[model samples]
Target chain A: MPVALEIVSPEKLLLSRPVDMVVVPAEEGDIGVLPGHAPMIVTLRGGFASLYEGGKVTTKLFIAGGFAEITPERCTVLADEAHPAAELSKAEGQRRLAAAEQAWEAVDKMDVAARDAALAALQVARAMVDAAEAP
Target chain B: MPSLKALRIRINSVRSTQKITSAMKMVAASKLRRAQVQAEAARPYAERMERMLSELAASVAGNKAAPRLLVGTGKEDTHLIVAVTADRGLCGAFNSNVGRAVRTLVQKLEREGRKVKIFCLGRKGRDFLRRDFADRIVGDVSFAGKRRIGFADAEEIAVRITSMLNEGGFDVCTLVFNRFQSVMSQVTTEAQLIPAPPPEAAAAPEAGSAMRAMYEFEPDEETILARLLPRNLAIQIYSALLESAAGEQGARMTAMDSATRNAGDMINRLTLNYNRTRQANITKELIEIISGAEAV
Candidate 1:
């Protein structure tokens, strides 16, 4: 059975397709769901989400922290900031990564919320770069 | 008689003021363009979010186990007003218009014997409400240094509001902001945040006894809704901020343009007065010299 997935961000709809499986970066860890997977709603961390379609991996998306709803038949992802890995510029990603690291080093200066936000941004930046390089 | 040096100094000052006003008008025009773009870009997201929420809320409204955020507490005794305004106040009546609308609502709510607490988003709003609703103010958030508004700021506000909700702080939450309709017209609007206004009527699916569409909830309706509700709030707040930014720029542009024209008019009138005074002075000197020569 094919699973219908709709990937959304506040700015625009990133993707809508029927795919065989989806690998989501849940808050806990990477969660891969095939058809007939258990109904679950998982909080997503900032990372790359891979979609498998028609027996081949079709696309990779970089998602900022958000939430995902996975039913037995469909998956819906609502993200704060989501973009196709191809859309992100390599230089910008690298710049964000560097900024995130600097912010992380000074994490103690920031409040708890700021630290978490910095971490999330760092994760998203790295994930985009990594996904672009991935086979 | 006034010294010529004094008149010269006055004229120079007016010229300087004219220059300043003209420069300000140009700056405001450029800022308005950028602000308009930001506001327009945010509309699609806001509209989409509303559509999604309405669609989901329609289904959830029928379910008994829907989260309290969606269903609301069903009591409106206590009210929380989130006032959105520009931190800076140069724009003519832009912040004050929103402030006035909020004031009217606050008065009306108080008259009805409802308890109203305010969470002010900008410094100008806070300043205005301080004299009247000082005791009712719970929190104040300002983006004084932030050149542009972002989701992170809205998320911070959402987190604070949600925690208050969880703690039973207020029964209803209302957002007051200036809705950007056009460059000339910005209508102030008050929106109810809690329970999300029951989704638009047209968005509700038709009532069909024969057709039953079953929705499978992931984790559970309550759980997903609990998380989604806060995100929706954040997104809405972010959208409001964007709208305010754009509205402020438009208002500033109009205000500055008018000011520049007024200054030009003032300068023209003053220059006419100065030239007339100089011409009269020359005529008086010529007449006195001729009369003295004839008498001699």
Candidate 2:
């Protein structure tokens, strides 16, 4: 059974396709969606989501934090930023990673909220680097 | 009498000005198309968010221990204003209208003996607000380098606002922006963002369903509300930004259209003056030559 997936941003719709399954980066952990999953709403962390098609799963995007709403018939991701993996530049990712690391190290001197934010950025940057370098 | 060279130069200058206005009009129209689409697209998400939040708020309203963000912090001594405008100006009265509305709000708030702090979203807003409320401004955000408005930009502002709130920045937060109505009119609106107001009465709970739907909160109501409140604020900011962008375009199109027409009128008037002056000169020369021949 095919599951309808839509990835939307404020400006425009990025992706709307039917796939067999999807791996979403939920706040707690990665949540996998199949055709008949129960209705659920989860906060998304900044990371990558994979969409599976017939006998092939494609790693399509890096989403920068938002939410995912999954119903039996469809799954929708409302992300802050979503770009195709192929569009991710290795140099940009590395630079961002370094910045995140510096920001994280200074997190201790920052307030609780800033520290949390720095950590989230660190996670996203690291995820991007890893995803871009993956074979 | 103006020399032929002077008349030619004047016409050339006016033509150049007309060309610039025409080009600006075209650019504004193209941008208006994209901005309108973005503004329209944001409406559904905002409506859904309001619907969902109202449902949640209605359920939580009965609870005495509701989150502070919903019922507010129970103080009105301090206020924060988030004013959104365009980074660039050319749109007639677009930025100024918003600036005027914000000024009115600020004065009213001040008269009530409340302290005001400003969070400016666009460069134009910052420039205007700083003129009067310079000391009150806590933050100023601008996407001057950005090619398009995106969630990341909104999120950055949201994060800052939420952090300030968590740190006890202000008692109330109000958003002042332009609501895109059509190509001819954009209304400036001021809305309360913090201690989120009860959803508008028109959008409130429907009467047909006297029975309330029981909702099972996944991570507990407080946790969900805590997370959702900040996100809702961000969404509101994002919506306002989109509306202002669209409104700016609409205003520019209207302004430019009038400017182009006005330029045409000026060119016509100048051309008429030039023609009459030249004809008078030719008539004077003819009369002089005829008198000289008759005298000879």
Candidate 3:
């Protein structure tokens, strides 16, 4: 049996299909899931998630921090922000990276909570750049 | 009988008013469709979040270490009422209904000797509540010029409420908004925000029940709950905003439709009166001419 993988953002559902495997970017580390995997909930960091089918990567999605709920038969990713990696252009990524860097530089002026949020945003921006440049 | 000139002017004025009402009705219908689509799209995320939070909350039901948001602050003497209404007012009693609900709630709370703080979301609610509850009014947030309601607007309100909660501004928070039932109906509702309400037993999905027993958290449960509680608050606010947006459009559509029909009826009546008056004048003139000729 294939695992049902669903990626949902606040704006809309990006993907919902039965895939052979899914690699989620958990907060601690990347976790790979196949059918019959143990049920777990993980906090997502800023990175790309790879959905596999027939031993090939079917799609890669850039996800910002959120949560992943994994059941044995299904995996649902509720991302704070998510977009298809293919939609992230290099130029756009670079622009975002610069903006994030500028914001990070001003993080010192913000409170502890705002600074932490800014750091997460910067990491997501970097991940976007990495996803855009990947072949 | 009224003069023909006066009746003709009245008919012309009524015709123009009917034209405006008909145009408003069409505009409201289109806006309602868009708002309905957006509200429907936002439901899945909000429902899923609610479900997940409820499950986690169920597990930590008796734990003392659970976040303050999930568990109450051990006091309920103070209440913060967030009344959400529309910025504009042509939608019949949509705003007034919400205002009435809030007013009733406030009166009840005050009678019970509980302190109440009113936070108005839109201008209409603020204007309505300010008349009687001016001293109780704390803050007002308006999105008057915005063409569309978005998550960002909700987030801003959530942030303000969270900050106030952190400062121990109020013991309980209640959100008052119009729940969109259909284009013809909207029911005013009050949802508790602070000391979040316990998840209902039926909220857990049957399919996820088996997996629920074996689920493990990556970090600690407390850590996840702490991070999730604020986000859940924001999600709840966002969904409420979406519902209010749809409700506003729905109410507007219904109100405009009635207004348009009423204008049509008035125009018809005015035209009929105008024709009758003109005929009376013509008949009177012919009768007078015949009378003069007969006398001669």
Query: Which candidate number maximizes TM-score?
Result: 3
- Deviation (Å) of A116 in candidate 1: 14
Worst 10 residues of 1 chain A by lDDT: A108-117
**Strongest candidate by lDDT:** 3
What lDDT score goes with residue B103 in model 3? 92
lDDT of 3 at A47: 91
Q: Candidate 3 on A67-125: residue-level lDDT in tens?
A: 88888889988888788887888788788889988988987754766676678778888
Looking at model 1 chain B, report the run of 10 residues with the lowest lDDT sum: B208-217
lDDT of 2 by residue, B155-230 (tens): 7788888778767888899999999999899999989888788776435456613423533344455655666676
Model 2, docking class: acceptable
Q: What TM-score does candidate 2 reach?
A: 0.84
Per-prediction RMSD in angstroms?
Answer: 5.8, 3.6, 2.4
Give residue B159's error in model 1 in angstroms: 1.0
Which tens-of-lDDT digit does each residue in B1-296 have in candidate 3? 77878878887887788788778888888988888888887777777777678767766778987777777677989999999899999998999999999999999999999999999999999999999999999999998999888876787788788878878889999999999998899999999988998778546468656656677998867767876787788888888887898899889888888888887898788888888878888899999999999999
| Model 1 agreement with the true structure over B36-133: per-residue lDDT tens digits | 77767666556655645654565566787676567667788899999999898878899999889889998999999999999999999999989888
Task: For model 1, state the Cα shift of residue B61 in Å.
Answer: 1.4
Q: Report chain B TM per candidate.
A: 0.92, 0.94, 0.95
Question: Which ranges in model 3 have alpha carbons more than 4 Å from their true place?
Answer: A89-115, B202-211
TM-score of each: 0.78, 0.84, 0.93
The better candidate by TM-score, 1 or 3, is: 3
Better of 1 and 2 by TM-score: 2
